[model samples]
Target: MSDVKDRVLDAAVDLFARQGYDATSVAQVISRAGVTKGGFYHHYASKEALLYEVYGDLIARQLTALEQILARRLRPADTLRAVIGDLVGSTAASAQRALVFWRELHRLGHERTEEYRRSRRRYHDAVQQLIADGQATGEFTAVASPEVVTFTIFGVINELPLWYRPDGRKQPAELATELADLVLAALEG
Candidate 1:
């Protein structure tokens, strides 16, 4: 992406997080990005197109991180712990953009919504495969189907951005470790 496109995405994410999809306008995004309307149009066909670019970037980062962690061949339980720990830190560092991604995906209509779902499924499949690997090796006991377990774990991990506040009192890794324990206890035993 060009610097102009990156600026537009950054500004779009901040505006969407603060003002919401319905409330934000293409003009506002352009102005905030400091790009002319022609430049914005050159990069994106419309507001929806711009949204997809921003969302795709977020989904790519998440999927890449998961792939890197699972590729390490760690124990299933340990891999999950590290994955969730990374998730907590990533969510803390990018809370506004994460929230915007979630909110806009939900706010989008059927066609664009389906695209988001596919991107989501790719990430979910990676985690489910890790769980299946663990189960096959007897590293993890399956109390629930891999799908169910993956979804539940993702639900817990992904919701952190909605409620997490960065205070000097607690660190993201510390909170992630606690969350990891809960996830392991629920799925492993």
Candidate 2:
């Protein structure tokens, strides 16, 4: 992305997360980004487009990470650990964007919303499949259904932005490690 486009996105995410999608205007985004209206239009077709980009970009990056992790072909437990670590770390790193995106997701148009849902479902399905595979192979105990376990892990990740603090004692890596440990322990039982 061009410097101008990056600025617009950063500004959009910050403003949208703070004021909200409905309350924010293109003019405010342009002003905060320090770019001209023309520059903003050059990158995004509309304010709605910007909103989509904010969350879209985050999910895109996450999807890329997921693919890379899967490519390693690690054992199921290791893969699950990597997935949890990546999810928690990324969510903590982009808490504001995550918070705003989750809160205002319904504001997106039907098509864009479906697109987001599909992306999320891919991630969800991958984790669930990993759990199912482990259980089937007897590598992991079937203490809980894969669906429930997947939801349990994701539930904590989704709520992380609410209490996660950048300035807090634990770094994202540390938190990820601890979270992965807990989930792995439950799965192993």
Candidate 3:
């Protein structure tokens, strides 16, 4: 993305998170981005188009993190914990965008939803592979199916934004380690 387009997308993400999709306006985005109406229109045909770009960027970032986790060679249990740690650790840096994506992007329709689903499936597949590895290696016990294991981890980590304020109570690394331990305990047979 060009600098101007990047600005527009960033502004849109913030506005969508704060005021919601319906409540935000193109004019507001333009103002936030310090771009003219013409510049905004040059980059995005409509507000929905801008939102789609934002969603695409977010999904790409997540897939990249998952790939990093998968590339690590370690014990299955260690790998699972490491992957969860990677997730939580990366999420801390982009928590704002992730939170916005989680909270609002579902308002998108079937086609966009399907695109997001595809990206998410790749992410889940990586995790599933790790779980299967764990089961195969016998280092980690598998009481539940890999799909179930994936879903459980998703359920917990995806909810982090609901209660994850950056107060002095817990640092990102601390929270991630705690979450990794909890997930490990649950997955272990």
lDDT of 2 by residue, 23-136 (tens): 999999999999998999999998878888877887898889999999999999999999989999899988988888888888899888899899999999989999999999
What are the TM-scores, per candidate, against the unseen true structure?
0.85, 0.96, 0.86
TM-score of candidate 1 to 2 decimals: 0.85
Ranking 1 against 2 by TM-score, winner: 2
* Residue-by-residue lDDT tens digits, candidate 3, 140-162: 67778899989988887787766
What tens-digit string does per-residue lDDT give for candidate 1 at 1-189?
789988999999988888888899999999999999999999999888877777677677777898898789788898988888777787777777777777777666678778888988887887788788888887778787789888887887678678877875678988888888887886678
Name model 2 segments beyond 4 Å from true. none
lDDT of each: 0.82, 0.90, 0.80
lDDT of 3 at 25: 88
Clashing residue pairs found in predicted model 3: none
Quote model 3's TM-score. Answer: 0.86
Q: Residue 171 of candidate 1: its Cα lDDT?
A: 84
Best by TM-score: 2
Q: Candidate 3, which segments miss by more than 4 Å at Cα?
A: 41-43
Q: What is the C-alpha RMSD of each candidate to the true structure, in Å?
A: 2.3, 1.1, 2.2
